[model samples]
Target chain A: MSMKRLESRTALVTGGSRGIGAAIVRRLWSEGAKVHFTYRAAEDQAREVIASCGGAVSASALDVTDAVACEAVVDEATEKLGGLDIVVNNAGIIRDGLFLSMEDTDWAEVIETNLGGVFRICRAACRQMLMQGGGSIVNVSSIVGELGGVGQANYAASKGALNALTRSLAAELGPKGVRVNAVAPGMVRTDMTGAVRAVAAEKILERIPLGRFAEPEEIASAVAFLASDDAKYLTGQVVTVDGGLSLLGRR
Target chain B: MQNEKSDILKTVTTVIAQALKVDEAQVQPGSSLIRDLGAESIDFLDIVFRLEKAFKIKIPKGELFPEKLLTDARFVQEGKVTAAGLEELKKRLSGADWTQFEKNPQVSSLGDLFTVGMIVEYLSGKLAATNR
Candidate 1:
């Protein structure tokens, strides 16, 4: 109908196979951005995401743990898309376990994929963004990062550290015309959360004042807003989209 | 060759003046970009970008500034660049005279090492290499 908000903009979204990452890809594409999304092991799902969007959206396999691979992905995305205007660090993994029982590998895997991955990709993207004059970075954090979860020590710590990184990068890159912000989602209904939702639906719903789990699209909307010109003045901010789940004090 | 060198000097002086927002007269060959023209750390990127556009040549990050040297312990000690550091800089920037920088190699004085004439010499060498 009317002109799209992100018309002619280019974006690179990490972990865009299924769930919240897929939703972000679709939302950014619908808003008129040329989206290049990354997937680790979901080729079929990644293709479906691109096919469904039906615009300038594309998908590539990327393992963000590899430093060289991360740099290559950013370089390829910039070259193919003409330029990089927005980077969405949505690629993250969760390893749920009690603090005592959490294996060293479990903690390292979650931290490397979630937080260290963001560091590598953001560092690469910042170089191009600096050269291009400006860009926006939106990291998908989680509410558990702030209010620690019982079985999610590793995930929570990774997301919590991501929030800190977002703030520090915002301060450093702000003068260079780049903006960095994060979105901390509450309970989003995604493929990754399907099992947990089935097991703990009623218990989880009770804590949320909104009475229902948020759709992936809702998280994507917040990410798109942060990446758009509307949030030009907003940096070093972590916008929580948890349907008031985080508002209630611990009982 | 003489006219080409003067032209390169003029272009470099104009770019530095515009980047530092200083008068062209203040950006002389002997004038230090940091001390005389008031160029700060951040202004280095702006000046480099301007030079790249004006000269249509790519300037590698560490070649002209050698920023990586600052991190190496051999080159910097106790907040000041060691004598070894000045010698390393001399090796990298062989075109320029390093008489003053050799006398005082404090980390703060590193910026003073970057003169308009140094940039002119660097560009001239780059252009000559490209032509060859």
Candidate 2:
């Protein structure tokens, strides 16, 4: 916050009304970025996040599943903030089910929102970023992408494809100066993960060497690094922020 | 006609120079985009995107570059472009030179079809068609 690494930078974060996305918005704003964020149906929570930011941060509703809205949000964020320097693709939905009984909607919604939404958002943002000469993009992925969860076949496939998409886009856009990367969180203490923790809190803790779930801020810090010049040389990488849970090899 | 060709070449040279981060003087008419200028597959995508923007024309995928023709089973045998394959390429990309390539026609040499002069000629044709 003191050095203000992101000073003069304008950022847009999706799914920012709660949990990890909220932390990213706060972290970017603290680092001196002009922040704009989106929420699906959390207008109240969005208000609180903006109020808590203690600045002129703006919040809007975006499903991220809507293709046209995905394009519009990027355009709005760029025009409102003057220019876009950073984008965080954090909007994702989880529909965990055993493969045998998983509904078609579960697979379709997870893939469409989590994986396809990133494609749409990045495609739209890349056009603007390319025009601006360069920018940074960070997709909030999950360790389940690398270590597939037993009951999360739909979720797992979505995140795995998301990581691959990140690498592919990085290769395509690197020469143009746009950086693309992903952060695979092990288990962050977020509203989205509340149900998973309620079911297997002790089992999950036993896996992570750190002996606890990550604070949302912990994952946000890693995303902030990738968004800044500190990771300027890096591209096409999946930075795992899982407290060595992945090191345990999915136990 | 001579002045227009020179103008198109100059713009194509600038676009190539910017995309590949090369000196403008190094991108000559006979220079092979990949072999001579060190353009990787990714760099080819960059050059194509920049060319479309600079020329204000949509270069359809696999058109400017004979991507499918190079991969067709009928045209290629043992990694060499067959006589019929050469004919197909000749019919397809009118601006690309086949005079030297006909001598070898190794599938690898297909990249040679994408020369600076070829792109200049291709754009000249595309621009003329659009203007008409």
Candidate 3:
């Protein structure tokens, strides 16, 4: 629907430098949200995202793994945007390796950034939300988190735990007016998935009922719906936008 | 002691009134927070948050309202407070009028002990220690 559902809303999109996070930034901004995005190291790409919005959306540097940094970034976003109405936890990382061969650092780093970062951001944002009496949190999870990919054990574990955390917090915070939800995208065309898709593009395409991978925009649309008043009644839901791939069965 | 007690009650009444969204007149010293003031589990947290800010004191989780207290075996048995439980409550809770509760100390009625008076009594002790 072509509606400005998020008009005048304040939003913080993490890792909004490229791909799905970038598309989400553009989408939320298009829907009339005053957007503040965060980028880790993609200064050039981050600038291009700002340019895409004609300098409307703002951005800052953030490493989600730093607990103190996460709180500071959230505080700044809340202050700069006037108030934090929506928080999209889209920053994540993957260390792909077979479970048996996976190094401790691989598991720890993936868990630290993907899961711990979300925990920190959500904790800080929820305080602001609780004081304001309500807000929305949309976590960007993955279909592999549910299907459990062969070489994505650490990533899957983090995402799975994230889904649980989302549900638990939704129940805890719903009474206080904050809604928490997750969007699980499958095989989106992003640099993060480029390594795996190059080797198994045909195999993955065959598994998906739609016969093609998702566009970043497709995932962004779902994030927008969850972040907006359009999905006010929806909370604690891990809505999978995977072109019916999940229905086919686990990998 | 009576004058100081009344002063604490006035402030406690205001905090509880705001937290529970009730009129100050409605929140009496004897009124039960849940039974009279329409409080639920979520409202307890709201009350705790407001109480901490109102009193300017930290209230660690489970200090004011320990959700798992009655569930413990030493304190309760078969849906009733045991003798040990009564003794524990007598020591920990100075605000409850245990004479009424002693007749039939059902665990369900444990929440009744957490009255506005109980909160005031707890805060009285807390603030006294802090001021000292």
Candidate 4:
């Protein structure tokens, strides 16, 4: 047909080199959105995604934590696509540790890159979103933000702060017609979690009522919903797509 | 714990409560300033200065307020508070009645706390102390 849900939209996804981010970029492009994404140390993966998405998608080498670099990426996207519409903040890094033994460097690095990076990109995108009268922002948080994990103190703190920011951003930008929402994902099969996949997989699977890890596509599906007209009235909400992991305690 | 010193502790507790952005009751001796209260590095710095003014006790410097003190404790490098500084605090306040203040309901801003009057008063006091 004529694309899909996001037709005529110009979108940007940070950390679109691979895994969940790559999946989002592909899905958005399929929906007819002119997509641009950034990747660091994943040049080959970035090129692969751009190749997969064809001419409608553009890939850039940039770090989300660098405010100036993040702005440049947004600027390039808007210039090439004629304007901006949707932004997906999917870039993140994990520095897992127990609170008692965790390193300050690891924690700060994760916070600065994951949480602060979201702030920088969102701040830049909001400027454009405000000027254009409206836009959608989907921040990729994590399931751990809702339920604390041992050895993930840093990750949890960063994600928890992101959830707070999502709410605050919605309040700040809603009056201007811009919507901000967050997606808290469970254990999705991604390259980033490949190391602990096996050991953590069984415990996580048991926690998930569905009894399985999610595919990146599943999380991408929820993101697409939040970024679409279907969720037009929804803002400041965090849609958890962890296959009922969040609800396991009740049942 | 209510006494003249308790009153001083109360004032100090209020300063910690304001700096950590938590209920005064939450600032117990055992309560972690970072983990339990969620204070970050910048917040700890503000708390340090506020503590100095509230208690009028100059912390031993480097030991009590090392820049490394604020790094994330979990990842050591990522967290914002330091072991050396925390240890120094423990030593300084040994046997002191650490009164937890009543948590204020309002979310106070750091920028708001550093008012023109508060800064001028603090500076004047510091100058007088040094001259003495």
Candidate 5:
């Protein structure tokens, strides 16, 4: 048997129960990395992902918003998986509303989960990675962060801050042999987008020059590439998988 | 005994100079680690790691720097370190001078308290405790 791409490596993906996160978990596992994934409320789905992967994939329930919990999860994953080589910060929440109508709770919840959670986890993981000499971190950002969605002010702000965080951490940790990058996914066929797709399928498809929504696996492939040695020199860059939606410019 | 203390100070200065990428002569006994030596938050971790390797002793977080003091409300009041905080710092860093830190007790200036002599004293005490 030929050696797999991620053989002997270990990965931890946050919010890996479904959608692009689940696909990333599967892809990393398929590449032969020992994977431990986290889910907030989808225990059964998380278990199913582990069962399907069939090798070293495992699942745990974690609330990314909790700083102590995030630290514990990183420590636990590193201990169990034997060493953390890759970290995918895919855990985020979306609260859609106009900026004026958005409640303080909505803004705080989204920011705490999406941006602050990444901060906590990355801080903990970087400690371990620095001690070990090298590692890679892939943050799951969104095109809304760059382009700004009409009803997603909170989500947009959170992901926008995430991109800045990715760039800053990349510069700080680069000398320590750690790499940080972000993936800004656009119009993926996830359960969250299914409701919007039903309402504005054609309108949404018109913006994408690709003329189709991206499957979760396609985004996962980009994430897997960034996490692999093939992208050893890539850092502080945001790879947009938006099917040219961003290129349309304010459409 | 005086020679041993001077030797420990020289070794501590060398380790800190190497960690911060500064010349040994630039790291004076009274020079502040942050203000004078340009050691930032991340640089603290590198310095600690290098100090551990150079001295062959463990320096736990919050022992040498006391990060927890930064969070305590009683120790930090009105965005600055209170007189109480300076008392705690005096106890923790008994070997170094605290006159400048006392004169300017703003929390932002807390890093200014960490002089090269302070690190030498902290590591010397740690080594003494371990050896004893």
Candidate 6:
């Protein structure tokens, strides 16, 4: 099938150097959105993604944790694309530790990169979007934020704040023609969860009614929809892609 | 000094109240800022900034808040830290031998704590010193 659904739009995905983020870059490109992505430390991976993607993408070195750097990246992407229409705040990190044992640096770093970084990007994007009439933002939150995980207290709190931030931004920007949403995927097979024990994976799979971890493309497809015209009516929503894990306990 | 302490407590309570969306009276020195008061991390940051502006102080960044207090989600969850405890932590932070504290891995939250009034007082001192 022709995947040109997103033709004529320009998209930027942070953390697009590898794994789920790289998959998102590819999917948006396939759907005909000119794409730009950023990586803090993955120079080779970022270059490789762009090189292999058939020449309509750009990748930059950016540490999303820095508010100034985030604004610059948005500026550069909008400059390259002439104007930006979609932004995917996919860049994040996990500083896992139980709350009791977690270090101050651990909590601050995760909050800075994951939650504060999203705020910086969204703020910059909103300014640009408002000037340009409108845009769409797809922030990548995690299932851990909603369900809460034991060892991922910092990660969960960051993601939880991102969820709240998403709602607040949507409320403020929706009237300006900008749409803000989040995709909270559970147990997606990515480098972020590379160490998941087989037993643990099985346990989670059982919890998911679909009984499997999602491929990166599955999550990317949802992102594409949110960034497209079809989803114009949807804002301030988190479309969970955990295959019913969140619904298992429901009657 | 006692009156000053009361004033600090009242000012800090008002900042916390504004951030927590509660009545100012609900924010007594012993009132729970997080749990009974329902303050989140952002609220903590917000009140910290307000306290700085109100009293004129600069709290150091980078885990300056002691480990124990930082990890206690109960500040928002249980609301258990007493005003006296908060004051003691503040005093300890003032005399904090940064070198000794950094070398010790004992991880006492009392050592790294930074409260609204503490920052307010620090800023006040700085402004006074500069004026001199």
Please, what is the TM-score per model? 0.84, 0.83, 0.81, 0.65, 0.76, 0.64
**Sliding window of 10 residues with minimal summed lDDT for model 4 chain A:** A124-133
Cα lDDT tens digits, model 4, B1-132, are 222444545665677676555688876644555556675554544555565655556744533334433343531322222344334433433332222211221112211222222323333444355557
Worst 10 residues of 1 chain A by lDDT: A242-251
Interface RMSD (Å), every candidate: 3.5, 3.1, 2.5, 14.2, 3.2, 10.5
Q: Which stretches of candidate 5 lie over 4 Å from their true place?
A: B1-41, B46-132
What TM-score does candidate 3 get on C-alpha atoms?
Answer: 0.81
Q: Residue by residue across A142-172, what tens digits does model 2's lDDT show?
A: 9899889888999999999999999999999
| Best-matching candidate per DockQ | 1
Model 1: per-residue lDDT, tens digit, A223-248? Answer: 99999999999999999999999987
Candidate 5, B91-116: lDDT as tens digits: 88777776776777888978877888
lDDT of 3 at A98: 93
lDDT of 6 by residue, A141-162 (tens): 9888888888899999999889
Clashing pairs in 3: none
Which of candidates 1 and 4 is the stronger one according to DockQ? 1
Query: Candidate 5 on A27-48: residue-level lDDT in tens?
Result: 9999989999999999989988
Rank order by TM-score, top first?
Answer: 1, 2, 3, 5, 4, 6
State model 5's lDDT.
0.89
User: Which one wins by DockQ: 1 or 2?
Assistant: 1
Which is better, 1 or 6, measured by lDDT? 1
lDDT of 4 by residue, A1-251 (tens): 55478888999899999999999999888877889999988999998999898756998988877889998999999898888899999999997767898888999999998899999998878867765667999999998887877888899889999999999999877866689999999888998788668677777677788888889988888888899888999999998988888898445
DockQ for every model comes to: 0.24, 0.20, 0.21, 0.02, 0.16, 0.02
* Model 1 vs. true fold: TM: 0.84
Error of 4 at A115 (Å): 0.8
